[model samples]
Target: MSLDTSLLPNNIFSLKNDEFFQIIKSLVGEGLCEILKIQSINSAENLIATDDIFDVFKYDSEELIDIKNKHFFKLQNGQYLVKTGIKNSLLYILKLLKVKKEEQESLLNNNNHEEQLDTKFIINHPLLRSLVSYYKYTDHIKNNNDDKRSFLKIFIDNIANNLSQSNNHFRYHDSVKQFAAVLYILGGKNPGEQKTGKKTS
Candidate 1:
């Protein structure tokens, strides 16, 4: 489904720019991309428990337990819903790049590092390549940097493109746009659209 844009929060971009980057950094640093890859394989809407998550990402059992306690996974009808959001979408892109959380964190920390982000993994990741190509086409108005793109732009474009391609009944471009609206609100930017005033069906 296409997003109306008018159905999103007005203050979705309220976060400071640095805070936005920090959120992105934390998501990448904590292996969120790997988690998202697993989720994508299994189906995003499928209710999965901690055991399921552990099997995919191999995160420490203790940490998984803590995440459960934090209500990251919502309980509905005795089933735990997998967490879904922009962060998960961004991580999925990173997973396609074969970028480890450590590597992403290191890059975030040292913006001036001469090392280049390896795109070799993209050769084997057709879907990721497609999504990245789509993102660059739709999001970039002008080419300022050489071959590199910012993590934020990549994240947004990937999510937008992925949502555009989703065939699932519950997954739609509008949902992804709403997610972007939330990010903008958190980042202290004034989102253009107003709330839908109606609950999501």
Candidate 2:
């Protein structure tokens, strides 16, 4: 039971311990204080109520199985994975901030900058454009099972090459390349690498 300090006198020394404890029990009901074992010295301890405690066996057995089943659901689809890889690849090209870009020279020359250049196109850089192209190509090959693994290897290799051209780009790029390599090794074959198995999605 938590006591309201305001209920007690500002000078606690004025009241006896017994008087303070009686006032505490009166403010909060009887059993509530019994749930907390208050000592004569004003120090209290919680006594775990063994009689009213819940038993583990009281829950339905099916509830335990339902919890175990939830672990099997994961989000890793081929199209989504490819899209994510392209996004990560684009991050290496430039520092993309939330700020929007606008045409400066044309706007200064005349107010009609809209006729000369698309304002939204200012955000498009070479690297981002390349990544967008790769993402679209990956989506295009969704049904062509024959060369899926090859497609992924080529995509990852392209990113790795791009990283190599820039200063220490491959440092972070190598990790992604390694991931792609692992996936390739673990039944991650190109379109023609494996002929017998069902195609990966």
Candidate 3:
């Protein structure tokens, strides 16, 4: 079924300039990380060109051109680069995911059961799926004791800390909460009740 864009806020397409930049930066960084996993590259110093970033994200030429025109990306001497460092890039992605999760929950709450199904499909869009994949990859790294595991742990801790500080009782989408559950299972424990912060085996 097609997604119901009408449910989204009108500002969805016209995000603040800074917000738009951060989203694209985060996406590019995540895409590069996936490419590094595929190529077995351990060093972050190796610069990724525009074509490589596009390939990793499976973006067609038209999409690439569109993104460039939107000023969310800059191609410098044929290489794609984010002004924000990798850590910030990752944090931005986490922030974006949190926003999406809350948005999805709000839509579900205000809609009928039949309409909620359409909301679920919209929440499963490719961009969110890619974020889920990134988290899954991080979980794998943590499990296997990879060299990058320490960095991934720090990233997760940063996200958790931020969430704790927000003090907002966000109702995340079911799939997003399920992903959190999977991460907990990978860490050898059952997931807690997210709202209550209590766990049961």
lDDT of each residue in 1-201, candidate 3, tens digit only: 233334334444445344444434445544435434433433222222122433432343653554334323456655454434544544544444446556766876777776877668758797656656777786765664653655555555556556766558544544445667889889876566554556545
Per-residue alpha-carbon lDDT of candidate 2 for residues 99-183, written as tens digits (9 for 90 to 100): 1012233445676666355444634567556656766776687643545655565666776677658666544445456766678
Q: Model 1: how far is 60 from its true place, Å?
A: 12
Error of 2 at 149 (Å): 6.9
Root mean square deviation (Cα) for candidate 1: 27.1
Write down the lDDT that model 2 would get: 0.41
Model 3 pairs whose backbones collide = none
Q: What is the C-alpha RMSD of each candidate to the true structure, in Å?
A: 27.1, 30.9, 26.3
- Which of candidates 1 and 3 reaches a greater lDDT? 3
Off by over 4 Å in 2: 1-123, 143-145, 148-201
TM-score: model 3 vs. ground truth: 0.21
**Model 2 CA lDDT for position 63:** 47
Model 1's TM-score against the true structure:
0.20
Regions more than 4 Å wrong, model 3 = 1-26, 29-32, 35-84, 113-201
Which structure among the candidates has the greatest lDDT? 3
For model 1, where is the 10-residue window of minimal lDDT?
A: 41-50
